[model samples]
Target chain A: DVKVTQSSRYLVKRTGEKVFLECVQDMDHENMFWYRQDPGLGLRLIYFSYDVKMKEKGDIPEGYSVSREKKERFSLILESASTNQTSMYLCASGVGQGIVLTKNIQYFGAGTRLSVL
Target chain B: AQRVTQPEKLLSVFKGAPVELKCNYSYSGSPELFWYVQYSRQRLQLLLRHISRESIKGFTADLNKGETSFHLKKPFAQEEDSAMYYCALKDRGGKLIFGQGTELSVKP
Candidate 1:
């Protein structure tokens, strides 16, 4: 089984403070993604990385940025936290290509619930 | 517009009763549909995909291109089967769009 771990299960930060969310996957998957889930809106992608040092913006990338320094690790950075940024952040990793992909099913972390005050 | 719509926000059924979660999509191109489940205190996981044409956990979903719908159904509901179910669509592009999700509750 693929194991995905998040740095924190819960986090609280003051507004205007920078925040860092870390994720690590043991399966050495090439594709990693960061998504924020909100009530009624479901899960929206923030950023995704196909390879080390390569990042692509997803639907909602206005307040977020991502870094992939290593193959097994992906990091999501909020330039400055705000109350509106409070949501459940999830990290997922996928191995190969498109939808029918055998390894494309992303293995998700337990998710980090961030509360910005 | 390319989007996924899960009509029912919440669905409740008794144990051993049949249950179905409706999902519809509006996409002009080839569509790939999948059902994902997130149980309480657990991470979101894949339940089944239309491409595989397989049933998972005794649940089956059939993608009807003519109607542009992929609804999940189970003959008998189990307490453990209750979870948040999401219908996702993957266009020809690699990106994915998910529905609002349906909260299923199985009562004993």
Candidate 2:
């Protein structure tokens, strides 16, 4: 079974504080993604990394950055946490290939619910 | 631009009733569709993918390129089937665009 593990289940941070959400996948996937899951708004991609030391901005990448120094782990960083940033963060990993079959099928972490107070 | 849209926000039904969660997409190129489910207190997981053409937990979805839709269907929903469902589309860039999602509530 593919396992994607998030570092935190729930977190509380004050405004303007820097917050880090970590994720690790055991499947040796080459693609890792960070997304925020909000009610009504659904899941919006924040950032994604297709390879170690490489990253790409997703649809909603403002105020957020990502790091993938290692292939097995990806980290999402909020430079300045705000009230609007309080949401459930999800991490996903998938095979990085040119094809669309299993390459796009992602396995997700349990998610980290962060609250910016 | 590739986009995925789920028309329903919530669908409530009694146990053993039929269920259909509608999903639509817009993309110029070939789109790869997938269904992901999140159960209560559990992580989100892949339910099925269009290319696989398989049924999972009694639910099935057919990709209709002509209609630009991939609606998920189940003959009879069980109480355990209640959860949040999301439809996603994989664009040529290898990125995924997700739908708004539908919350399935199957009551006894």
**Best DockQ among the predictions, by candidate number:** 2
Clashing residue pairs found in predicted model 2: none
Clashes of each: 0, 0
Off by over 4 Å in 1: A97-103
- What is residue B28's positional error in candidate 1, in angstroms? 2.0
TM-score of each: 0.96, 0.96
lDDT of 1 by residue, B1-108 (tens): 889999888999999999999999999977888999999999999999898999899999999999999999999999999899999998555766789999999999
Q: How many backbone clashes are present in model 1? A: 0
lDDT of 1: 0.90
Model 2: how far residue A87 lies from native, Å: 0.3
Off by over 4 Å in 2: A98-102
